[model samples]
Target: MNKSIVAGMLALALAGCASQQPEQPFTLTVAHINDTHSHFDATDARLELGNQALFTRLGGHPRLQSHAESLRRQAEAADQPLLFVHGGDAWQGTGYFKLNQGAMNADILSRMRLDAMALGNHEFDLDNERLAAFIGGVDFPVLAANLDASRDPHLSGLENLRPYVLYEFDGHDKERLESMDDAGDDPVVAVIGLVLEDMAEISPNLGELIFEREVLAAQRTVRALREQEVKHIVAITHLGLERDQRLAKEVNGIDLIVGGHSHSLLGNFSNLGWDQNEPYAQVFTNQDGRGKTCVVQAGQYAQAMGRVSVTFTPDGRVSQCDGGNTLLSDHAFFRDIRRAEQHRLAGQDAARVAAFIEAQPNIALVEEDPALRAHIDEQYKPALDRAYGEVIGHVPVELKHVRLPGADGQGSRVAPLVAASQLYWANTPAVQAVTGRRADFALVGAGGVRNSLEPGELKEGHVSLELLPFANAMSIVSLTGRQVAGLLLEAINGTLPEGAHTGKFPYSAGLRYEFSETSKGRGYLSRIEHLADGRWQKLDPQAGYQVVMTSYNASGNDGWNTLYTAQQVLTDRLDLAFVDGRLTAFPVARLSKASGGGTQVHYINQPLECNAEGVRCNTDAQAFIDYVRDQRPVLTELTPATVTLNRL
Candidate 1:
């Protein structure tokens, strides 16, 4: 009797569902920075203005605070939802980190109020205990969906360490966008963290933790978020731009990817003397072929901030995305800051440079936050100044540190010099006597040299605090010529893929090679030679040669697997001590087991006197400083290219 009534009821219900409107499209504005790397003070930057070179100060955490506050106010006034996120790498770059470790980073970042930060590989530069301490101190969550820290003793119980965070915004009030365990019935935005799956291969201090493949972790998390009725998803990733692009293309639910790790300065900065052709916010079709994902990353060292606006459709797909990276610059400009008099830009020249900066959409003039600046000046700057203030040497010209050779066919101008320094240190009588062998060649990774050598008075701070900041122990590994060739091929091939991290690209002293990207087999590399007795000779495959490199590389991190497989590896931990009013390296001896079951003779930690006389011992930095001081106008003459690239 009720069949007709049931059919009518069903028809009415279907009509009601169809008539209901879809959820309203939401537009979100995101402010992001990546790879700040503990650069708390303003850094010198050069820009091309009006066909003339203009030197000015770029970003610092203080400037970042000021700029972020300005962006927050603007978003609030406009009634727009905004989020400030960091794409990881907030540790290990400058003297600030050397002195204060992650403590300073935690303090500054907590004050700036980041929504979330991805766990960068640099975060693992220290042990898990230290990383856990950092996580404990930060106000915001440190995310890594791919990281399984449950096995780690220190990070296992941390509450702030999470896979993802959920935010349910109420209208334009972003302050109400608090991290929630559940979003109830409201439409929610999920921020997921993804890190490199090969984290251990690059960062060696991750203790008892496991990292899942980034793609798998991201896909699984996005699917779970979607299952929970969360539509909008953003992935803050430490996987470099290339991997981020892959993540965007492979995963369907991610609406945006904020990334770091390769320190890519995305956007068009041609006007500023830097050429970056990649658009800041690039949109890609998701694996499902229907969804769209937008990817963005700010440059390193807090120099630039990325602001992106994304319009999400009712279905949580990115319908439109627009944004660019704005370099944070100080108001002051200079013709040449190195010149004491008449170098400061003033009058008409100042006005012209200001006008140029103002006209550019990607440049922002910002002042330092007074409170942060004062804190740094009082609490941190003095210690750094006292430790690294003395003038070490001078650089006649800027020595650029490009990881890979650019279109000009010139690779890292600074890395080879650094390699030369390592070689010199390895051949020193003290080091040679301890190791029982003189190093034949020295290799340094591009990533090891943190910053470029600006043409000016080089300070002790510049070397230890900025340029070569890691203070890695030096290792001399005896390898056959065949193994060295294999090492170069592996390292170079790892970086040949587009957008790959070029840090692994090798730079060497006493060694040179030609690489062909299009060639196959051994043809990819040719003319492999080592400088012997002041002459270049083809590397004999059967000959045993002692190669000097950082302990990080000798352990097979960063694709230097051949070094780990070397027959003989000797390591030295050099501590800086002022012995008889001279900066001297105090060598210690110890032993450790290598990954390839080879014995690693290294030095263990020993307390040394770091008094007023000057106790600053880092083998790499000290060697470079010593070399520069001994050899004036260092890097003035261009040497034969260490790595010659043939893209064809």
Candidate 2:
């Protein structure tokens, strides 16, 4: 044995060990908001503070900006890398968007210093040209890995509309690392965008664009980034909280998901009178049963912002994750926001409420960002104020809107009213003249009605611009009782599954049904009835009836494909007719040969005049406004519950 040979071999092994040092762990801070929906002004929310029900204003864009900027400053002082992002649905909820459209959204969000945002379904509420204009105006990149805009002339050339983006952080300063030259080695984290795959079914204006499957897109993008040596991956998604969890379970290498669309308030808000018990930063094991992914979502309408701190191992697995939604609120407290002047809290009550908010880790009383607030007040708000100022009617009590029926079988208190309005408007002489038939019933999905009807003066702005903000035209569809029953069953079944989207839950006027989740009977629908001559009777499967709904529903969006198919069949033999100096089209269901080979057509479900008239022809909103105006002291009862859940 040679001593010199042994020593040289030992030195070589030591050198190899020195070169294989363990990679240092990285920690990233993230601030996120989702489903903002153009709610720039503070919205009223009731919280049980100090054992008293108090009304408080929750997060608006200004408050969100102020809190996010503060967080940015804090992270900078601590030398921690921070990324601010939105989970999408930043358009089309309030009067601001209704009046100013996506321009206002781009202006406000661009100032928030966002890193990236997912494309929400509402972003396609208008045409692709409008969406492209919005993307051009925003400073941050809009992402959608599943979206293929190559065929869209308006969106194909936008450089900032990308599938994913990479960010490199310097280890020493914790600042974003950028290359001075064209080539760079690798980035620290990759932010991937994922949206709903069936976006076309839900959003009608997505012209010449395509959406791929969400899970597949996410998997492919994550793999691509991993191959590029980018380990830490965060997916900003608009797939809702339930789908986000599913994505986390199915995808590998994803560390965290910031989500929207479900508008889930994920945190323990039981103390605040909210029954939200879902854990923030919810963790799920990857598809390969290795690594972990954390999910978080801020509630809808800019009511809260989620802040999460994630620590990644050397191999990019999520080691430790922590955070919750921060509900930004104002200092002023009231017993009832509708009557603030009469219900103001004072002295010990006010102090106790303030103390409670201060003690909560997820609640903060923050001042609005002065510049953004001033901009909103001066630039975009005046026109909205002036246009929506007229008082339409008054209500004595608030009508609540719940997307799904409760365990006790109680559904939304507001959506049924909206349905009744459509039925009322359809039966009017002006509307019936064009259709040549009266509407037997009306159906409205829960998602169509955005907000609860507050108890106070009902302004034109609240109904037309906020509650039913989509401005969808009213549509009448003629279908047999069998088809009507099938439509209800399809909608009910779509929402009955676990983690299903409850927005498809149907609320109706002049119609009622009993549904059982466990029943094998006709898609879980046990019984269905329609009101006729103030009497409720079983829906005859063969009887023909005219159903009124939004044009969005008639076109078969949002799990209502049956209606779309039925309308399409009738549309094949359509005819145009002039009634009262107005031109309208109707679906011709039957054609008979008259004398001399002339054909006579039978019309059904006349298409309302929506084009040219603009938002003025939004009969869905107009109907509700007219109903409230005609029926003084608006209806407050939720009785004759449209849906009954039979648990058997």
For candidate 2, write residues 94-159 as lDDT tens digits: 999989899999999999989999999899888789999999999988999998888878999798
Which segments of candidate 2 are over 4 A away from where they belong?
A: 1-22, 171-187, 519-523, 571-615
In terms of lDDT, the poorest run of 10 residues in model 2 is: 592-601
Best by lDDT: 2
Cα RMSD (Å) per model?
A: 4.3, 5.9
Candidate 2 residue 51 C-alpha distance from true site, Å: 0.9
Give lDDT for model 1: 0.80
Per residue, candidate 1 scores C-alpha lDDT tens digits across 1-648 of 599999999999876643332378888888999999998888888888768888888999999999999998898888778889999999999889988988999999999999999999899876778899999999998999998888779999799999998776665664324444444445567899998898766876666788898888889998888776677898999999989999999988899999998788898888878886688889999888999899999988999999999998776778899998989999888777584557887888788888888899989899999999999999888998887877866778788888988756878778888898888877877666556678899888888888777887888888887888886656666678998899998898887777877888898999999887774322378679999999999999999888888766766778776665552334343433345545444443544443422234344554443323444435677777777776643455347777798775
Residue 601, model 2, lDDT: 35
The positional error of residue 293 in candidate 1, measured at the CA in angstroms, is: 0.5
lDDT of 2 at 140: 88
Q: In TM-score terms, which candidate is top?
A: 2
**Whole-model lDDT values for every prediction:** 0.80, 0.81
